[model samples]
Target: MRQPSRQGVEQALDRVMRVVTRTPLLPMGHGGAQAWIKAESLQRGGAFKLRGAYNRMVQIAPEDRPRGVVAFSSGNHAQGVARAARLLEMPAIIVMPADAPAVKLAGTRALGAEIVTYDRATESREAIAADLAARRGAVLVPSFDDVDVVEGQGTAGLEIAAALGHVPARVIVPCGGGGLAAGIALALPDAEIVVVEPEGWDDMRRSLELGHIVEVPADAPPTACDALQSRRVADITFGALHAAGARGVAVSEAEIRAAMRFAFAHGLVVEPGGAVALAAWLAGRLTDDGAETVIVCSGSNIDPAAFAAVLQEEK
Candidate 1:
């Protein structure tokens, strides 16, 4: 069977629109240049992950649905997959890092997914998820590397272009596994793509520099946001980034906290990982290249305590 394409991603915008909210494209007037933000944090389950999760879930073979589904996520992906599976009435087993945010861990459970937590500093979530799939006979849904997932994520780009009514000169996306940025880059080849990462979780940055996916240490002297916790780079996203001539930037955790405070002051609620792109903008990471810019506002599943603690620590 033929795989889904860019056109399919476009059509899915309409299909998903019925279930998922058509998040707004608002201007980042605070930052110079015509920066429009794709507020994906407003999606169901508090992140854009739901878009791909539902798009991919709704298309699963009916015969294959009974075997159930399995996935590994740090936070947003787990919640998105769990929520999508619940809607389909399929059993879901989600593997998460033991250090996953309380909000994400609880959110996935609330969505009725069975929880399997592993050591983040030592264990491999891939191995855990793979084993879960083998034992349960479930389909493993990779957070960002699968075509279905990538196609689903591309819908964000489609909507951004449509909403903006024209292609932008540049687009900024926060990178964890690089799926979101890759999806946008794939869909909008006409635009320049830059990835903003928490200073330490710069996997894509280091990966592109090395010309291959390389593992980056998580606690290698940690700073910056939560939810940017990723250890591997994905081929699915790397291909898109390379094709789009993408660049990378790193933002300090202090800068991210300042940006986060600015967002909250402006009535925007964004998690640390999701706020990296905006944080990059606030830190003056881009030039006014006459390119209409769009930043992916990806998620908002915040742990109440961490939120308060970060605010206090930053203060």
Candidate 2:
């Protein structure tokens, strides 16, 4: 797989920033380290997924646009793809886990995308989506595996670097399939990249350590981070992250909940998956290396009741 480059990222920024918001960088002090939170939680579709989805959609051949596109995501990418397809006046079909958050499912439907639900524990969303696309003559869009998607995600790094006026010493990103982290690593070659994940679904962390792809344990406990529940990391994304010498960390559910509460205290609405980077930092899992750090608060697509319950938990 070809590693995403800064040039590709620059092009992606040129294409994506025109449609997506340049999400803000909020300054803060975290664990005695000077930090900035890249608030992608406020992005279109309530996550950073829109950048890649739109980037890919806009480039599809005019003839291919009639055939439409297909994708699989728990929620964020589903919304991203759905919203992008809606904007492009193209049909979109999303294969989602039946157990996905209600807000995500409804959001995808609201955007006029056809939804197909499968058993997360017993069925493969990728296989189902691929089959659907093949049958319909539609383009299959991988959430984090494709070159265009990765480059689009890299635009976030471009925005971050431009805002900071330089590549920060460290970039902490929440990882599911590794696209965002991989893209950031490519975009900011001089910075240390740290990918954070929920404990039970830390395949990306293990994959980075083992120097190979590793699937999440089949019996892994249910997690609130539906967006970060990728069973395995893709070769393209893992390759970029590996080449960048990126590091990884996993945080417990308790830590994730705490991070959500912390975000709430800061007047930010962050989904569980999106809070992993902050969770890792708050739990002391990441070393305070005195680097000017940017923590990617990746998304905010939680159901209101679910988010409220999480916030009500006592520390």
Candidate 3:
């Protein structure tokens, strides 16, 4: 498929609004800087994944609807595709990490999708999902690599810009496989796109810096941000981000925890992966660049015990 464009994103916004919630743009400030939070954490399915999932699944050929679809996700995207498929009255199968968050796994099951668990350390979710799709003659809806999905995610940027009456000076998004960042970059050409990833999973960051794709280190350390654990970015996403002149930052575990706590204090509940952009901002990793920035708080489906511990750690 072709790279997502502004027109494609506009079309996606129209379709996505039919099913997804238009999350609000909230104002927040720290030190001398002010920002608008694109609170996608409030979206249906508890994350922005619903936008892309619905947009892609809804467009499946009417004749092929009975065949359903297959996907792979650690959490958020699983819920997205499952929920969408449920709404479409189609069967859905999700290949998920065996150790994925309980809340996420429960959410996917609740949405009526079959769950196929795999060992993240040993098994390839892609290979498994592909095989399932081939076996069932089902459509494979990629989490980030597909053009339709990218366009759907970009609707967030459209909403943000429309709310602000113009493109903000900057937009910071949490990155996994670079879908959201790439989409936002296309949506707001005038704004600087800043992608934030967990420290050890900063393949996109390094890839951008090195001007080529880079896979996550084989011995990468554990991270709480399971939703952002993409091993590498697809060429489609990287091409859009690179063309948009995007920048990147990596957030530490402590920083992500602090951001989660900070968001909670502000009456927003954010997952570890979802809070990375805000984490970078809170940790002073993002300098005062004189831009009216917008940070995407991407998801909210965090496990209760883990959230409580992060909040308690500071107290």
Better of 2 and 3 by TM-score: 3
User: Model 3, range 52-121, lDDT digits (tens) per residue?
Assistant: 8988988998899999999999999999999999889999999999999999999999999999999999
Name every residue pair that clashes in candidate 1.
169-291, 169-292
Better of 1 and 3 by lDDT: 3
Give lDDT for model 2.
Answer: 0.92
> On TM-score, who's better, 1 or 2?
2
Better of 1 and 3 by TM-score: 3
Error of 3 at 134 (Å): 0.4
Weakest lDDT window of 10 consecutive positions for candidate 1: 1-10
Rank order by lDDT, top first? 3, 2, 1
The lDDT for every candidate, in the order shown, is 0.82, 0.92, 0.93
**Candidate 3: residue pairs that collide:** none
Off by over 4 Å in 1: 1-5, 31-34, 312-315
Task: Choose 2 or 3, whichever is better by lDDT.
Answer: 3
lDDT, candidate 1, 1-315, per-residue tens: 334456767766765676777789987677345578888888888998987888888888898898889999888999989988988888999999887888889899999999999987778889999998998889999888787787778888888888878888888999988878887887787888999888767879887776777777745657545566777777768877876789889989888877777777767788888889988988888876666778887888888887776667645
Q: Mind sharing the TM-score for model 1? A: 0.93
**For residues 9-78, what per-residue lDDT tens digits would candidate 2 score against the true structure?**
8988888877898999998775556689999999988999999998888999988898999999999999
